[model samples]
Target chain A: MNTLMRWIGIAVVIFIAAPLVIVVPMSFSTAASLQFPPPGYSWGYYQQFFSDPSWLRPAWNSIYIATMNTLLTMALVVPATFALVRHKFWGKSFANLMMMMPMAVPHIVMAVGYYSYFGELKLVHSKLGVILAHSCLSVPITFLVLSANLKGFDLTLERAARSLGATPGQVFRHITLPILKPGLAISALFAFIQSFDETVVAIFISGRDAETLPRKMFDSIREEADPVIAVISTLLFAVVFAGLIAPSLIKGLRRMAGGTPSK
Target chain B: MSAYLRLAGVNKTFGNFTALGHIDLEVEKGEFVTFLGPSGSGKTTTLMVIAGFEKATRGEITVADQSLAHLAPQERNIGIVFQNYALFPHKTAAENVYFPLQMRKVGKKEGMKKAAEMLDLVGLKGFAHRLPKELSGGQQQRVALARALVFEPDLLLLDEPLGALDKNLREQMQIEIKRIQKRLGVTTIFVTHDQTEAMSMSDRIVVFSNGAIEQAAAPLDIYHRPATRFVADFIGESNLLEATITDAATGKAHSPVLGEVTCGAEGLPPLTDGQAVSLLIRPEHLKLSREPKEGRQNAQMVIETIVNYGDNAVVIGHAGDQQIRVRVPGADVVILKEGDSCHFSWTADAVFVLDK
Candidate 1:
């Protein structure tokens, strides 16, 4: 049973990791199209991906839109989470349901709704249209992450601060904000990823001027299987992998530095 | 001199549920008072009302003759050490202590220096740079104490601050807190359900039951002369016998278990003839003997159980239908056994009468 379980675990890991294995090497492949077991390996596609303005513009646009979506989502979600978690008022349950409504509805349905609504508003093909739509889609996940953090927060800390002569504003600034810094950062990261990876809404409202990276990738894959897509995918995976490991890496470096000074 | 901290007819209600019912209390400056009661009693609610965390719905609270009604909690200048310590996780011990000074607009350099000094006062001298999570529970308690006292606020309210500590540490923190409060001469109110903690620390204890003050007096007075049956039963171990005052003039009462009993005691409320009352005999005051001792009121009971506590033991037995507890020296317990008929004796001075 133990050996069988071990085999199953390894098989599951390999299955989950199959995409990275296929994508990373194919990114450097000398093949003409998106093909595995390539004829040869080179950095040719990586260079092309960096040099092409069409690919580059969408990459920058995705970054800009994701950043804006994160900011807007946090601005809406923070106060909403605090209210929903901490207070009692009329229609609170209704308000809570509305906050989580976008997560329940399908993204394709939302994309179709925004495509026409934004078109009538003369916002189609503009960066603001994509940003606004992504912000709405980002709200549920942002609120979920933030509200969980807010619930676990010891409210006695605020009362203690007040007793220590800090005003409500000062308590939030000095105690609540600093203590919740990590949770806020994680939730904002989730909002950014949601926007950056969102293809449906981006394809709908982001017609040409505001075409995002995911939409561009979708268009390129349909028209001509660009190996540059694999290069972009590999670069994104590296960026995310670096982000995931950065905290522990910093901690390890600090421990080494601290040990050296002590010795 | 007027009381430094006063709650006059303070009442708090959450919709229909009354939390604090007409509380009127006064504490002199530099006195350490404790609010002692079980959970859901008005002890912690009264503390919150005084700290401005919970507003008193009906009555006014004043500190130093200044009304606290118009002031927010920040403007009231009170310090609180919550039950959980409530230390800011992100801030180092020194930074946590410096926070109040920072809110007062003190420069960071001077504030941090003061914070370090305060930490030293709490016996956490070199722990200034460490975050709260790095410290042990007792050390975290000390840091919390330092943080609360760093600003020298008008009042310090501790809400069961040592309830989370282990037995040894809880006792140690109790002594430490009392010492710090004395050294600083801050008017402090500590809340706890632990009767021993209340007895060992407070200059005065206010006993609460069911949203009202049962009795507020010195610790020994509260133990020996509780004003009501609840206070008598709550403060310490007691054998509260149902009795009626037969003769108010001679201080005599009748108990079913002890037959006729002499009940005159100092500080007892005035009794009347035929007045229904409770006769309170403390467990420690009752002496257990093999035979009825001369010149002492005695009752025969069948010993049902003996709870030994190394130094002392409680002998629980029954006289008729009444369960009587007699605390005897642990060494004396060997002479007695369960199911043996023993005579428990008490003098009239040890029995106090409470009106039913």
Candidate 2:
């Protein structure tokens, strides 16, 4: 049974990796149109991706908007998650359901809603509209991650600190915040990635002035099938690969350092 | 005279459940008091009230004539070592100890120096650099003690800090905690459900049951003369007998198991004739013999079971419908076995009468 399970796991990995393998080599292809097994290969698409202002503007817009979305999402979610996880009050279940409601609705449905909503508010093509819309989408995952961490935290540490002459603010600064740093970091990263990779809603509302990278890529794929999309996909894959492997590499190094005999 | 710490008419209720009921206590400076009780007995609730974490529903608490009703826990200047030893996991032992001093705005050099000294006082001289996870259970307990005591707060509260250790380590930490508490002359309240720990470490034991104080007296007084039937059964091994008083002046009581009995009258209240009462006798106070001894109260019982420990054995038997227990030296077990008819005797002073 174990051998069979191991073979199944290997097959699943191959199934997920097959599409990504195609994208990496296709990014270097010199072909102009959408062709899988390209006739030639070069770094021409990479040069075009880096130099063209049309692509560069959307890339910058996505970075700026994602960063703002992360900040706003964390600011709103942290205290709300603490309250929802730690205290009991009336209507708490309803409030929790409301926070997760955006995630329940399909993004295509939200795209239509935001199109009408932002057009009425005259925020249809602005950066602020994209940020506000993305923050709503980011709240559920951020709250879920943060509330799980807050629940696992041992509350006796705060009590001990308070008894040791730490005021409420000092307790939060010294004990609660430091202990929750890693969870906060991961939750903020999730919010940033959620906004940066969002395409459907960005396509409906980001119109022309605040065009996000995903929205621009979607349009480019439909109109001309720009090879630069493959280049961008490869770059994003490399970045995620580095992010995934860095923590374990650092942990292995620490283990080796800790195992050495100390004077 | 005003006491150092006073809790007057302190009552706490959570919704419909009463957690504490009109608790009034006064503690002299430098005295070690143990709140001994089973779970849900308001001992910890009282501690939280004193520590300013739980607000009393009605009354007030004062330490040194200063009302604590409006003060937050951080302003109470009380140190507490929790049952789980809530040491900061991210900080070293020295840093954990220095936290209170840092909060008080002490300079880093002086605070760290004092922290090291406190660590040394708790016998953790070379262990100042290790985190709490790296330390053993007993070592973590010592670091917690050091951190709680480093600032020399006005009061110290320990809530079953030794519950996590094994037998030998628990005993060792008990002595160590008592030594540190005495050396600092800090007014301390230790809460524990273990009666043996209370008996061995406390200057006075306050027994709690059902959110009320059952008895508050010195350790030996609480042991030899429990005020209530709950105290008698909760503190130690006891054989409680239902009896009726025959004479108030002569302290005479009649029980079905032992026909006529004389009880100690030093602290017992006045009793009326034909009043129902409970007679308590400690297990070790009863003497077991093959025959009735001369000049002592004796009763005949059929031995049902004998549990052997290394140094002593408990002999459980029945006299009529009442169960009796007698402690005997291990050497006497060779000549006795289960199912033997034995005579158990005690002096008048050993029997305490409680007018339930």
True contacts kept of 1: 0.91
Task: Give the per-residue lDDT of model 2 (tens digit) for A2-73.
Answer: 999999999999999998889998999989975798779999999999999999999999999999999999
Point out the worst 10-residue segment of candidate 2 chain B by lDDT.
B263-272
- Across B187-244, the per-residue lDDT of candidate 2 in tens digits comes to 9999999999999999999999998999999999999889999999999999999999
On DockQ, the candidate that comes out on top is: 1
Model 1 has a DockQ score of 0.65
TM per candidate: 0.97, 0.94
Lowest lDDT block of 10, candidate 2 chain A: A254-263
CAPRI grade of model 2: medium
- What is each predicted model's overall lDDT from 0 to 1? 0.93, 0.94
Query: How far out, in Å, is residue B46 in model 1?
Result: 0.7
